[model samples]
Target: MFSSDIKIHIHGTSFTIHTPSGKINISLPFLGYQNISNVLAATALSFSLKIPLKKIKNGLLATPILSGRLELIELKPHKILINDTYNSNVSSMISAIQVLDKMPGYKILVSGDMSELGKKSVLYHKIIGNTVNLYKIDEILTIGQISYEISKISNNGKHFLDHRQLNKYLKKIFFNKNKITILIKGSRNTRMEKVVEYLIKESKKHVNFVV
Candidate 1:
């Protein structure tokens, strides 16, 4: 999908198409080469027939982001929040921290355990903690069993056994409006978003609820 009229060369095949959006080259998996070729031929036919851009965009927009990927929930003048807690692995954890480092504002990491990696579980948790510390995060609150290990390795973060303890502390001790950016990331099983609920409780009062 080239934004301008340009030739697209794929494998040994080459053709030109007019696309208003940026050029996109899709490499189909090699399981069924004939099927992929057939689809590509059909798509080319559509282009030859001058298909409407609205129809193409509608088809593209039907697809959604993959589950357990970075999902942005809010962006405010004082804060930004991401629901990247859908899943966690070493790669995903590092990516989240990198995003925090590049963004301007105090970063709050709300992390939990990354389960089912078996033997590497402890090492993975420690890596997440190490990643958090390597960044200039203002504060960190960890949840879940493995996340407790993350807190142990953290230099300036706290660990919570449950949201109950976290809520109490946030409401009583560390409550601040628009003063920080929050990253709520963890495994889905940990239900870390309960902490986000606590933030909303305070946010309804017009406090800056930056993500």
Candidate 2:
């Protein structure tokens, strides 16, 4: 029920499709090319084959947003929190920092090291530190080994190598009366949710955790 020939022009590459699933003829433009042509070609072929559009629409609407990935929770004036701890890659980390930098309120970064970089592990950690400095983050609290590296670059931030250290420090400093805003972020493995939990409404000693 679809066209015999399907075409996808990505990066100025033309892929001509024949069968529902067959070898595709791909021609890419000059400079910076990868073999992702096969993926594009296959997608085109499958799309042309026989997939219901209603199923795609239903899937898009029903799919829930992944946790800790740009989850916004309102608390008080200028004290909103964004939970972006579901996953962490270099690009995602930089984007989170950029969001903090652009927004107002005393921003706090409770982040952990991004995992699975293979050989560029240390280099990536250092890049995180450098980006923090460039963004001029107000405060940074990190747990775990590599996360400590990120905190070290902050001129006015605290680094915690373990959860116990972080918990003790937060207990002392996270006052309920203060009017400062906070942002908590990290990799999913670090359990950044605990920090958010502690900042909930029950704790009256510190600034209002929720407005």
Candidate 3:
């Protein structure tokens, strides 16, 4: 459980935890409560190993996000992208959506598919849909057969047959956006990382070329 003194800010969160020695204040470079929960778990493990609390706090603050695993990218003057294409499941999908809900801007979830479920894949997808609705996500865009269930259940969702079609739609929607945050996710088998890469590449298109 998190300490009651937790302060979540736009860019980060700070919390004070009681330890045997006294109280230790911890801070992170990111704001997601799920991210903070992971840090708390890691801190517990470190405490069990008799590691110094100062070092634990410092280490947590310095750790960098693994690429394509809830990676946060700034899209120039107005938008942000959360690339969570490393893997997808009922829990992780919900966690990612929760993180997106904390962000500022128009929230969008881009999903591919969660694979390797012998059965109940559709049910799992529907759970994510319910979660999106619960959080009142602004929109959900989906690709793939199993993932389509998410959009179908969401109040404002659309399904794309292919990446090109989705990308085309995103470009149009992304134009002149005041503020937007997109969370892209799927299992490795779905190759959703391609969509992340395409978005990043497209974001750099407007950069002035000095030649």
Best by lDDT: 3
TM-score of each: 0.62, 0.60, 0.79
Q: Supply candidate 3's per-residue lDDT for 89.
A: 84
How many collisions between residues are there in candidate 2? Answer: 8
Off by over 4 Å in 3: 1-34, 41-57, 208-211
Per-prediction tally of clashes:
7, 8, 0
lDDT of each: 0.61, 0.61, 0.79
Q: Model 2, which residues run further than 4 Å from truth? A: 1-66, 171-178, 201-211
Error at 85, model 1, angstroms: 1.9
**Residue 68, candidate 2: how far off, in angstroms?**
1.1
Per-residue lDDT over 80-190 for candidate 2, one digit per residue giving the tens place of the 0 to 100 score: 666676778788788778766755666677787678878887778778887888885678888777877777776666777677677666554545425454567776777
Q: Show pairs that collide, candidate 2.
A: 75-211, 175-206, 175-207, 176-206, 176-207, 177-206, 177-207, 178-207
User: Which candidate has the highest TM-score of all?
Assistant: 3
For candidate 2, what is the TM-score? Answer: 0.60
- Give the candidate order by descending TM-score: 3, 1, 2
Cα distance off (Å), candidate 2, residue 135: 1.4
